[model samples]
Target chain A: MIMIILFVFLCHAVTFCQIEFVKVPMQKKRPIHLALYQIKLPLPGVVSILHRASGLLLFLTLPLLLLMLENSLHSAQTYASLVALFKHPLARLSMLGLLWALLLHLCAGLRYLAIDMHLLNNLKQARESSKAVLMASFLLMLLIGVRLW
Target chain B: MVSRVVVGAHYGLRDWLIQRVTAGVMALGCLSLAIYLALHPGLDYQGWRALFSGDAVRTFALLFMLCLYYHAWIGVRDIAMDYIKPVWLRLLIHVFVILTLIVYAIWSVQILWGY
Candidate 1:
């Protein structure tokens, strides 16, 4: 087992070293590394990416959310017990995180809605919508955070 | 060609109708939820139960759940179209989501019905 482990480690290290070794092309070629720092992604791009990310998070975290809701609704005693459980710091933080995720997701959904309504079809409108999403998400997080606190 | 056009028209109309209907459903549900939250103000275990157990509340809550699932499904479908590459994998993912949503809707109904 030790010998096999050592062999695997050596092979991995060799591959890692090769990856780190950047090949400098003599000619411009296809100019693959075009102006490395010149490109700037817009707010809409960032918001679009975060919308998908938050959606994934919500999807993966859904089972826990459903469990909590079910537990809280089972009976008066179970509901009280669940509420008490949420008094812990970890639970509070988790709930706050969930709220944050939800706020972002809702903001993104609103952006989609605006697009669907043809309210933000142009470049300028799209940019403004993206800014609105960010601002709205921040404001929501603040309100919810205060409430949670 | 005529058959293809007829089937295409059917799907297009169906999807368009569903999108509009679900959008309206979610809007109403969300508006009611907002009003409920604003009016109630505080949260207590018994109060929460009483609040949800009423017939009007139960019906609205069921609509809310349905709208939520519908909206979520449409959103996920868009994401799958944007990201999922292989047609077979996309179909599998869509089937899984449909099954899960059906189960969740049934479970929610059962709970809401006091069963």
Candidate 2:
């Protein structure tokens, strides 16, 4: 009720002053176009996603890794059996994938540590760091691959 | 309606701090393990057991496991909160993850000390 009275007095004052009014449409709700495939990720953005992906992969497989540790610790026989399991082609492939994941996660995590320390302040430095991380991880994985083979 | 305005503000700084702290702890643990491995090559089951049998390394490794789970909780929680739109679903996942990490901690203890 008080708001209604104030509006009436404001209307009278506006009329006395002969102020012109302009109309505008409501644009509070705007359309958003967010197509995932249409978007291009920057180098650092790609590295960020890969970091999360690798972490998630490692996380989901934690149980299996823990089981391997358990077996290795159980006894010599069990430890030999676990070592034998690693020789299978499927096992080796998955091991490679996991190694790569660990490498990527580790490198990206170190990069994040540097970022938290205010080292990668500029866009160029961030991008370069991301590139360096990817290269280092990939090269490390390849080195592990050669040793594994 | 009940207000849900303050959920995001309070936990942000704490979780950020935890994630970095846990990362640093785990990094140190891994670095020490790597250095040890570099010094002692061709580790068999006995050799590996000897490494973990030490009190200091074993304690640090256990600490690393705890940090890993806590760090993982924060990361996975953020992922679920981002990608899982349904509140109930995210809550369910959060609960499951908490339970699983608890189990993993127990498993780590068993692996390190249990026969």
Best by lDDT: 2
Candidate 2 structure quality by residue, lDDT tens digits, A44-101: 9999999999999989999999999899888999999999998899999999999999
List interface RMSDs for the candidates, in order.
2.6, 0.8
Per-candidate DockQ values are 0.17, 0.73
- Note the Cα lDDT for every prediction shown: 0.74, 0.87
- CAPRI class of candidate 2: medium
Q: How many backbone clashes does candidate 2 have?
A: 0
DockQ of predicted model 2 = 0.73
User: Which ten residues in a row are the worst by lDDT in model 1 chain A?
Assistant: A21-30
RMSD of each: 15.6, 6.8
lDDT of 2 by residue, B1-115 (tens): 8666321224558999999899889888877876777687677999998878888877888999999999999889888877887777888888899999999999899888897
Model 1, A25-86: lDDT tens digits are: 43434456567489777899999888878877776676677667677677877787887998
On the 0 to 100 scale, the lDDT of residue A7 in model 2 is 100
Error in Å for residue B100 of model 2: 0.8
Error of 1 at A11 (Å): 60
